[model samples]
Target: MKFTLLLFPLLALALRSQPRSRTGVTEHVTLNLRPGISLETTNAGAQDWIFQIVGKWSGFQDGHWGLELGDAPTAVYWFFNWDSVASHQEFTRSPEYPATIEKVESLASSFSAPHVPLQPFPPREVFASPVVSWVTFNLTGVANSTATTNWQATANDFLGNLTRVSGYRAHSSGWEVEDSRVFSVLVGWESAESLGAYVISRSFAEGFRRLVSGVAWEHRVLRVAGYVPKL
Candidate 1:
């Protein structure tokens, strides 16, 4: 009986190890909550809506955040994996889509809807208080080819160093499909405050500074709004 239990785990691992492919483009949404409104307050109402939507809807994998304090905008981000962008466009035309958009907008002071195309990378799941750091930067005077190299190298450095951090969760780096020179990095942390610690550490500071020295970058550190669906 004991050996059988062990074999079950091995069987499960073998199954997971088999070749598998995931399809879909990820959709990211951000909401800058209205003044005086807090994430805690928005979370309860958002959770209610998520439960309803996920129960009947398809395509949404997860929504996460990279929240910040001070004058920076507060945002909630969602990722959807659909077969094609056309499918997502069709989904927007659905009756439920407008109502869903309205509910989300009602919670924010302003939101972003720019059509920045992104190439999807394998998605990673993150738990805990998931603090995300979003960094978008423009290369300075560097050719596209050179910029691509820098981007890849920086991504490797950041992700490689992240593994040594105590609270690391998941990290994704991607280039803008329309303009490959523009890139974004999203790194997750276990707790809201954990990101701050990592950012101030010598390791992160040295690597980030070396990478962004000649570049103009915008970095936003945010708190993840808890809106996980049980289903």
Candidate 2:
């Protein structure tokens, strides 16, 4: 009875000493800027307006976000770092968040829903060095839940092959959101040429056929502006 009493206080102390923060992850939003709008102008507006507000918001002591441009004049990407899913969710409820979204949506023709990395998926490993190509895909036609599971398994096998290619920094493939069949895959490369070389090679052809068949996909390659280390 005395030993049990002593152990209980120690356990209570240990639990009290535990940190409150959760593992950090990146929040991504792919924007389709308004038609005929130049990326330069859109980016300039974002820097002036959207970036400014998100910077002042709580839980973003790191900085607001990073921006990138893809192939088209209308394509833009926003990447924000947050301590956890709850932090990001909490930010959305802030008064400034809705107004910020309203201003940003005004610039885009359409935008993909914000996509944060899902749990049970390992936290992302972000390289310190900037990547030359940031490729993103929006995919559909994944029919049923079982098919989705099979696809993810096949993708895991495919990722094993992709990592062998030189200059492949990081790659992750998963659903764009939980409870949705639509999915996304983001890959980083050393350069556009490096990615091009791999795409045309025999190895890529085989994997692409197996994993991508029957899926309708839209993709764009972005020139990453800066790199953010994994938090």
Candidate 3:
């Protein structure tokens, strides 16, 4: 029995190896909480947290952040080809879950959703790519119509000239001036090579620099993730 048990792990390893796998499953998330709010201090802190699933949540580390912050946070998001909503449900339903009930109870006052649009990616013909996702968030102070249009036009001009890339699309969600001034964008690249080309390509750099000069904000960092669905 001992010898057979020892072989089980090896068999499992051999059956589940995929050398070609290089990305994590993509997920698009957006957060909007009423007119005046933030989650760092009150919600994420509590004494008895027994329900939110807090393991292995990095799904899209390979994408890029293209925009800037808003007045408050008109929105927050992550977009990529996720396995499915089923996987998220499974994690929440698991017996060992931690932040499930606790978050709801703690965040009852702060959380408000004018929209809960979680719809499947409709079967459509996109450029030659395995999967694609797009995320949107509000950069609180950037809701002004004039500056954003110019930025979009100028930035779009630069990206338009970036050669040798795939699955490129852009969407602008509104921002809340009370929280921030500019909104951020999440764009996906098919492979590392494509990402490299974009960075090294002078056409893209010149355009990005010009856009950056217009809006300056303190305390800025970017978060990226890569995702691949197993389904």
Each prediction's TM-score versus the true structure: 0.68, 0.68, 0.35
Judged by lDDT relative to the true structure, which candidate is superior, 1 or 3? 1
| Candidate 3, backbone clash total | 49
Candidate 1: stretches off by over 4 Å = 1-23, 65-74, 79-84, 113-122, 127-129, 177-179, 227-231
* lDDT digits (tens) for residues 1-231 of candidate 2: 012222322422332343433655445656666676654553576545776676565555332222353455455666666665556556666677667766765667555444445342332342232443343333456677788788778877887887799768777554543224555566767766778888889998998788777766555566665333332
The pairs that clash in candidate 1 are 66-222, 67-221, 67-222, 67-223, 68-222
What lDDT tens digits, residue by residue, belong to model 3 across residues 1-231? 011222323322331332322322323323333333344334333311321123243321221111113344433332333233333334444554443434433333222111111221211222123222333333234447786777668656654554344434322222221223434333434544555565676766676677666465322212232222222
Candidate 2 ranges with C-alpha deviation above 4 Å: 1-25, 35-45, 60-72, 118-146, 227-231
Which digits, one per residue and each the tens of the lDDT, describe model 1 over residues 6-80? 232242233234233233444444555666655555455664584466435554444444345445445555443
Better model by lDDT: candidate 1 vs candidate 2 = 2
Best by lDDT: 2
User: Relative to the unseen true structure, what is the C-alpha lDDT of residue 207 in candidate 2, on a scale of 0 to 100?
Assistant: 86
lDDT of 3: 0.34
What order do candidates take by TM-score, descending? 2, 1, 3
